[model samples]
Target: MKKYIKPYYYYYYYYYFYMAEKIGIRTATIVIKDNRLLLVNSKYSDGDYYLFPGGGLESNETIEEGAIRETLEETGVEIKIEKLIHINEFIYSNDWNKRSLTIFFLAKPISIRKNNLTDDGGKIKQVEWVDISKLDEIDIRPRILADILMKAKGDFDTISLNHSVDYKHES
Candidate 1:
């Protein structure tokens, strides 16, 4: 007679959740402090909007690595990842289907150099540090990116993603 082995039923559920968590939308944001926060003005289908100096994470790269690489590539500034401030989930279905899970981190600028890299085959129009005090003057992506920075207190803090949406139709 052969020995019989039974598998635990909970294992399947656990694995499913783990995989979902791993692949559940991913993005990164880097905050480089000068007198202001480092922001990138990039072309969007709907005119232009501002965002931090980070983007989607490439395969095999950790979030920190991605943040550093993206920031360097976008702004030509090497940055040290300080702490994660917030994790946001963005969902929008309009002109195009889009969904993202973003990781926002507080970073310190290590060096400043000119960036020759460009996105979408065009030169990056502008890379500038805006005063943190003037955050309201710019159109920031996810909006909460700025809010968390203003609210961060001590080191290594985490916050749930909270964003309010208003309906606006663009032609």
Candidate 2:
């Protein structure tokens, strides 16, 4: 007998309750300080990966509020959201049911917690500040995001990804 394994997204989509029409709204915070970007190393079923500090939005919180909250929870750092940088539509062309929209915000840290880390459903391994220039060397979710951020020149651009980034701006 062959053992069957479900994809990571399947477990996520099936377990979480979306507030609106099965469309999930996620917020990510991009905090850079001293030429370093804040990122969380997390473990998934497939493997470990790095992502910005963020998570799904709650019912009562505004987008900015949610972003701030999620960032603090995941990174143990208090942040002030500066502005919206990227809006990503991560919808699967083949699976409409597994659709999510992610809003990325540029943020600045206000306070830092020493040795304090919040549990992202027990998935987060550690939070670290990675040098901005070295972002390409790691595995980041929504892979194209690393490329876009690496080349971004203060101009905000929206990215729509069915399976890849569609908008590319060269500075």
Candidate 3:
């Protein structure tokens, strides 16, 4: 007789999530210092897109811990995690099979370190403190910069968006 094992128990959590095309939870921080939002300006094929400082949650890491880690890794800044503001589901029309849940939190910068990319995101073209009034000029991902700027604190919001984000799946 052969021993039987369950695939779910053997496979990695994220890998299983990816294979199933389920909700991938990511964390991001809205670091507002001196009334300016911290944004990473990256040049993509579509155009320059600005995004908050964060990334997908890692295995065995708490959301708060992952949020802080991602902020530092992407923006070279340490942030003090605050309240959660929004939970967004990004559905790419180009690739409907993949989806991600972005948890946006309102946080403050505690320290500034060297900007490093631990998750292989292309070199950040520029990390700018974008003025709230000037947000309309640039294209931002998730398409919720306006709402985020308006409701900076208290209460949570959810947005289901179909947009273009270069989320490449490994073969």
Per lDDT, the best of the predicted structures is 2
Cα lDDT for residue 131, model 3? 78
Expressed as tens digits, the lDDT of each residue in 73-137 for candidate 1 is 88888888877777775544441334456677778888887754545344346788887767777
Prediction 2 TM-score vs. true: 0.75
Each model's TM-score, in the order given? Answer: 0.70, 0.75, 0.73
Best by TM-score: 2
- Evaluated at residue 159, the lDDT of candidate 2 is 47
Q: What local lDDT does model 1 show for residue 41? A: 77
Candidate 2 residues 7-105, lDDT tens each? 656666666755334666889988989878899888877778898888888999999999998888778899998888777776555544555788888
> Which 10 successive residues of model 2 have the least lDDT summed?
162-171
Model 1 bad stretches (over 4 Å)? 1-24, 94-98, 116-118, 151-158, 163-171
Please list the C-alpha lDDT of all candidates, in the order they appear: 0.65, 0.76, 0.71
| Per-residue lDDT of candidate 3, residues 1-171 (tens digit) | 224445545576656665667667888888888878899887666677888877778899998999999888888888898777667766655666776777778898988876454544564687888876677777876666455675544233544233335554210
- For residue 113, model 2's alpha carbon misses the true position, in angstroms, by 1.9
Model 1, C-alpha of 62: deviation from truth (Å): 0.6
